[model samples]
Target: MTDPAAHLLIVDDDERIRGLLQKFLIRNGFIVSAARDAAHARRLLEGLEFDLIVLDVMMPGEDGISLTKALREKLTTPIMLLTARGEASDRITGLEAGADDYLPKPFEPRELLLRINAILRRVPSVSETQSAPKMLHLGPIRYDLERGEMWHGQTPIRLTATESALMRIFSACPNEPVSRTQLVEDLGRDKGVGSSTSQERAVDVQITRLRRKIEADPKQPRYLQTVRGAGYMLAPD
Candidate 1:
């Protein structure tokens, strides 16, 4: 069962569908908010943070794909797109836009609920155990596996939620090559969040961001090195 207090934002141009989803999700133990369109969603986003966002692909203006792209530029909040049935191209486009997942229209409420739970489960909970030192020494930088915190000497380095999650995944299996598909899945994005091209690009962006903090030379990363045709590996000293 999902946490009742988990906040969710539902954005759709269709009033009936929006209302129904809001009511259903609320009944299933979520704190739900509804927005009529992308513009309204943007307004709500400015004032509040959400655990997840459910967005519809078709809208009067600023469709879900465009909004997803905009949000990905700054936010790491998980997003799920609703697309019409059999729209493979649409799904690919949505993923390219940085959506974490995509659901087809006419989906069962139960399936939606399940998907939501699956994504939420990926977010690590902050607890006492998280503070322990499973430290990875990377030259001038240090990453605490337990706390998911990175530090440069006495000064702490800040990481986005998505970056932290990626670190956890990599640290859990050190020196192992994790495929892009596996990383996307572990990141709690739907299989359709993006096409291979988009997902690859997203991974590259994240890797670059992470390397800047942990690597003495982001241009020539030694700790976070790419494997030939395999994926990426973290070689913490």
Candidate 2:
């Protein structure tokens, strides 16, 4: 058999689903980790850099969307949300909430594999060059895109993989508004949010985290401003 192409994290409340998905994904050539819920997932994330995260939306507490939002603060691993709710609005909501892809429940495992492959395809290969802004001025913070490093004055500020990836994406098109859906796609995350409120709620958490780093006050963001109805924009000075 071929070696595993990537490492995967599977988070679900249901023991059965988690076990099945883990076994299936491993068989298809992936090293898999399983988490019982948000708390467990958080612990796993702190210690691992996963290639992808397969998350189920409905859970006992701190549901998938909440976890997704929290994870985006520090990780760029791809996420695919699975749920029993299959409404069209639900799917759109998922995208708005910063999910890369969404699949309804009772889906064939093969279909999940196909979707996983499709999302992985969107990721740039290691050899591909992602030319980025040499140095970004985020108020007092200076970020080096190529090095994935950040500095406040002469001191260095650590950036998690997710945070570094975010800076790279935003710097690529400074002064441009990036929709939550686009950001989700760029970050390679997938999860569920069924309406405008849900979408904004999830996206807001991520933006808030980013703002705290560069803004004098995250509550009243000066650098990353909301675009009324459009989306979030990064205005670097």
Candidate 3:
């Protein structure tokens, strides 16, 4: 179940579909907002923060993929693309653009609900009460386990939802290699959504993005290392 206060932004050019999704998601315990196109979505995004974004791929002005890529430059909000195109390449393109998930058009509301909940579940929850901070050090980077935040000295670093999830998984077992298949399962990418290979590749993309934040040089990562024939491992200092 998703947090009842979880806010969602629905961006679709079609009024009928946008209205229907807003009503459906609201009925399912989400606070929903609707946008007719990417421009409207950007306007809303500037003033308000949303737990997740449900974006349509075929918008008139700026398409979902372009908006997603742009938003990822500053925001860490999770985005789920709704695409009419079902090709694996299209889905991978969405993932490459930093979308957390993609649901092809003509999907059942229930499946969307499931996917939304899964992504929300992956997001780390902040406790109202404070506890001693558990820190993981990677070069100059510091990750707080309890708060699910990363820091460089006094400045905070932003992490997307999927990147946060991956950090949680790796931080739990530092210096241990985790297989691509296991990483897929931990990230909640179920079978039948896309081929296993594509899902692993998506994970690779996410890892590359994350390395940019944690490693001094992403191309030659020192903390997040790849183990030959095994998988990736986090060796924190």
Better of 1 and 3 by TM-score: 3
Instruction: Please rank every candidate by TM-score, starting with the best.
Output: 3, 1, 2
* Clash-forming residue pairs, model 1: 95-193, 95-194, 100-190
lDDT of 3 at 117: 91
**Candidate number with greatest TM-score:** 3
By summed lDDT, the worst window of 10 consecutive residues in model 2 runs over 121-130
The number of residue pairs in model 3 that clash at the backbone is 0
Give a tens-digit lDDT track for model 2, residues 1-237. Answer: 222578888999999999999999988988999999999999998898887888999999999888877776556677788999977666656544556668888899887887777566554333332565567888888877656677899987744334555666677788988887777666544433245454444456557666777889888888888888777887887
Q: TM-score of predicted model 3?
A: 0.93
lDDT of each residue in 1-237, candidate 1, tens digit only: 656789999999989999999999989999999999999999999999999999998898898888988887778788888878435565556655666567887888988998788767656555523553478888888887766678899998866556777788787777888888788777755443336666566666667778877888899889888888889998888
Best candidate according to lDDT: 3
Show the lowest summed lDDT stretch of 10 residues, model 1. Answer: 124-133
